[model samples]
Target: MEFFNNHTKLFTAAALLFIGLTIFVCIVPALKNQSENAPLPNAIALSDEAILGKAVYISNGCVACHTQQVRNVDMDKVWGSRPSIAADYAANYRTDFWRNTATVMGTERTGPDLTAIGQRQPSAEWHLPHLFNPRIVVKESVMPAYPWLFEITNKVKKGDVVVNVPVEFLHGQKGKVIATADALHLLAYLQSLKQTKLPEGIPEPNFLYKKSGDIGEKTAGGPKELDGKVLYITHCQTCHQSNGEGLKGAFPSLKGSKIVLDENAELFVNVIMNGYSGRVAEGYGVMPAVGTNSNLKPEEVAAIMNHEKTNWGNSAKKVTTEQVKKWMDAVKK
Candidate 1:
């Protein structure tokens, strides 16, 4: 009764209760979230160039179509090795007084998710041309080209980064397409989008609700034969078209290539495993090490090779997993 009569005492008690409630409700949970969602040990901090690229990414509204998140579903597995986790986005948060930027986990995904793009497509050669014109690499791509990020220069300087665009895609421009600072920064950011690996012994989160037909099955007469058409679409269709006709002067066509028709697959295996880095000098963008990047099994390689050999009227000898394994082992220098 005495405390109620004293207004100051009553207000003091109410203030203490408010503070206690805030500590219990807000502060404690925030601290727990911070501890549990700590950045992964394998997480790499963004480079200076990547930071600037992120700013460019934001300004261009790239988040509108492309998502950084890989949802926990079997269909999303193609975008990442594992399901998206809280720690995966821990590094994307930057809390400070002047600037507070949260993760760019976009809401809608018109384009494919970019969570593991760095691991999937690790070639600047592919990226540069793709940015210049999405149709150059992916014919049906709806993504807009960022041509403003490049400069057409008569003479590429000593340290200039050249973007190898198809001559047909250049639209009568004769000068070399050089990557400006913004383009280089954007490439750096895209290359840094690799998903962090889980710690050793920690069980990776399973992609829930897998479809029955998602896996390869054994044939009635032979061993398991994965759908090579599906594999080609997933790994190669963007650069090498569905018809096996890659763009002229950019990506070489595999339709009638000697490498595809060769009886001996030594050179073919080497090209897939290590990539043809020398292709840039030959006026084509370099091929990426798809086998290394995607962790392609011997069976997978055989399937792709067989698809390339048989399709587009090539009629080359179909490869087997055992043959591919032997050839792969031989070419591993």
Candidate 2:
């Protein structure tokens, strides 16, 4: 009895110490890991204007509606790629104690997730219009317009003292002007959509076509030529004719679509895999889903995209499998 009573206090003190250490081990790492695994902000290679735009994004409560993280649930599958990790965030993020980074990511999904949005839509012009008036790009968009982002000025570059307007705003009438900061910063942030590698392997989204000089002589028995023709006829012919004359009013004529003719060919592959729907031309309906075509292989898509450009009146730039693979990579925002 004497021994037990005398040691009771000492034993209790040791017990408490053990419990505290156990709790620290469990909790401290979790908190540290959260930030360690946090994604880096995929900031774009910003210019003076884009840097200022980043300030705008932080000031406005845009993060309230949009989330920068892509969870591993069904959402990632729907959007492509998997949930982001701390390494994915890279050096783009601005850090702080509260970690306001993506804390405001609401669960409502009122707007599309902004995780890899820059990869989905890389056009600066499109983003500018969409921000000024979401209705221009997304007719169904319920988002309010940021008219304050617009600014009007006669400021002209020293080189060519002609065009006062650097870009056309979405809702701006002839006289009104919008701030370009929103466009630049938002684009910088959007362009930061580069994620890690695919789980399986790197996807092939060949944006460029190869030439004989680029890859030596063409293969003899390879399906390069025939496969290209077949895929285009089977899939593309519905919208773009066998002769490459896309339907006049409905489909865009591929005869000279900048996307098709660009020397950088992977753009076509990304458009195909992602399935473009925006108004590349005015009044056109959303593009149909095509990457889901079971019969179409990544190689075949690359071939057709190349053949279409070079065939008919189009120039023949040989596309390789490698180029398509690169385009399939998570686009660097």
Estimate the TM-score of every prediction: 0.81, 0.47
State the displacement of the C-alpha of residue 28, model 1, in Å, after optimal TM-score superposition: 4.6
| Poorest 10 consecutive residues by lDDT, candidate 2 | 160-169
CA-lDDT, candidates in order: 0.86, 0.57
Error at 119, model 1, angstroms: 1.3
TM-score result, candidate 1: 0.81
Q: Against the true structure, whose TM-score is highest?
A: 1
List per-candidate RMSD values in Å. 4.3, 12.3
Question: How well does model 2 score by local distance difference test?
Answer: 0.57
Per-residue lDDT of 241-333 in model 1, one digit per residue for the tens? 888998766688998999999999888988888788666787776786777656678988888888899999899988888898998888775
